[model samples]
Target: MDPTAVGRSGAVILRPMRVDDVAEAERLSALAFAVLEGNSDLTRPPERAAAWQVRTAHLVSRDGAGCWVADADGTMVGFATSLRREGLWILATYAVHPSWQARGIGRALLDAAAHHGRGALRRMVGATTDPKALRRYRSAGLDLHPTMVLEGTVGATAMELPLHVRDGRPSDHEWMDSLDRGLRGAGRGEDHTLLSALHPLRVIDRPHRRGYAYLAPDSTVELLAASDRRTATDLLTDALSGAVGADVRQAHVTAANQWAIDVGMAAGLSLRAQGYLCLAGMKPPSPYLHHRALL
Candidate 1:
């Protein structure tokens, strides 16, 4: 159990998803994402409530998704979702009922999830156009990596953590909300452009497809050649040799990923210079890569 998750009045409860909690989760997301503190563009369509429903359905499905709800005085006020991929666990979505914003509910929920996810040295990400979310993440010991927007090409900072899969799934949902939060919060992506980019690739041949199973349009190619500049250049040259007319002109690679960076350079993929942040409980075995190879 999460010790930090006491209610505002010191009686709040942190618990797993319940049969009847779906509606409340939707309601909280509507209130929170709709009138988010800083981002106003999200209020323009479908109502935040409608968007919440769609996101909730994605998070609770049996495809390695996890969720948690917070109740204050028996009222559902906040919810969080975590999505799992091969070696990565990302916080996909989270919404706090408007009535319960500044309280410790969010932190408590995060703590509980993190506690449960012990020994994984997790890399979690969060996105928020809302100033409040940015503040909350910072307060909760998350540092800013790179601030990116998914506009013409997918551009965003990548974070990493080493996690051991249990029963072929990640241990928790605490980090799941970050990816969706970043995308929706960034809000620069359009369905048409994404579909157009992803439509032509019938076969995506890339090495590392872990952590990014949710990529929709383009296939992210992940393989490390060598740490040296020459190796980086050669690896990319080889990868793109077979990529003629495969429907991708752009890609993302973690700055720390030496081979991918070399590939990006040789292929004319300009690094949209931004503040990229990195965290590790211990040194990584090799340079970790975060690529925007797919949606």
Candidate 2:
């Protein structure tokens, strides 16, 4: 399928994203999110712009076939990246230049991503705090549900677990995939593989049960997937303990998953903000904690 099949409309063009578009995509993403914050209670860190750029580049490098860009004449106006793994397709990051909003560029870019993954996409998911953005996603066929962001300083804690913690290895992909599927109802093999290589994954090895959490280099708890609340708490406790030297540690939890939220609060984290997890074609699983952008 030619992602660029939808050609120029007046001066706008919808096309597949390229490796070179990452820098501009990062700029537009930062600008778009900053503007979005102005319309909602959401807050973004000053360093997120650079962080988003790096994440965007990684997503493009990992799944370029699922990324698309809307170009106005020759300048990029908008972009969207979707990560397809098994039955899931996540709209990982999406943004349009503030100057170019309301002109259908965003819609086109979104459509291109959906089209590119139509054959394999069983469910689609995304997150946003802005009502206008919610409307756009709803209009595109997703159902919105409440989610929250929890953040606070990470400190040493004395929570002991029955299982031992160890760094994840490539051989553990099968266990990771099985655990993720059991918890989230979908497998994120590709995402887990990429993240494991890019960041450190702290794993709990028990006799029959296993769990894992991704501790980013910056000490943020990027994601945690476990079979039960106790295992989840143990993983999070380990993550927060390791994050003792970092300025901040954060996690995005589904509102329905009060256990996970309580775990964060018990670990000395506070409610930072709230948002919605919009899903299309499936119900979201509970007890899941991941970055909002990756929802």
Best by TM-score: 2
**Best-matching candidate per lDDT:** 2
Query: Per-residue lDDT for 80-99 in model 2, tens only?
Result: 89877666677888888878
Judged by whole-model lDDT over C-alpha atoms, candidate 2 comes out at 0.71
At residue 240, candidate 1 shows an lDDT of: 49
Candidate 1: which stretches are off by over 4 Å?
A: 1-11, 37-66, 83-88, 129-131, 150-202, 206-295
| TM values, all candidates | 0.49, 0.85
User: Against the correct fold, how does model 2 do in TM-score?
Assistant: 0.85
Count clashing residue pairs in model 2: 0
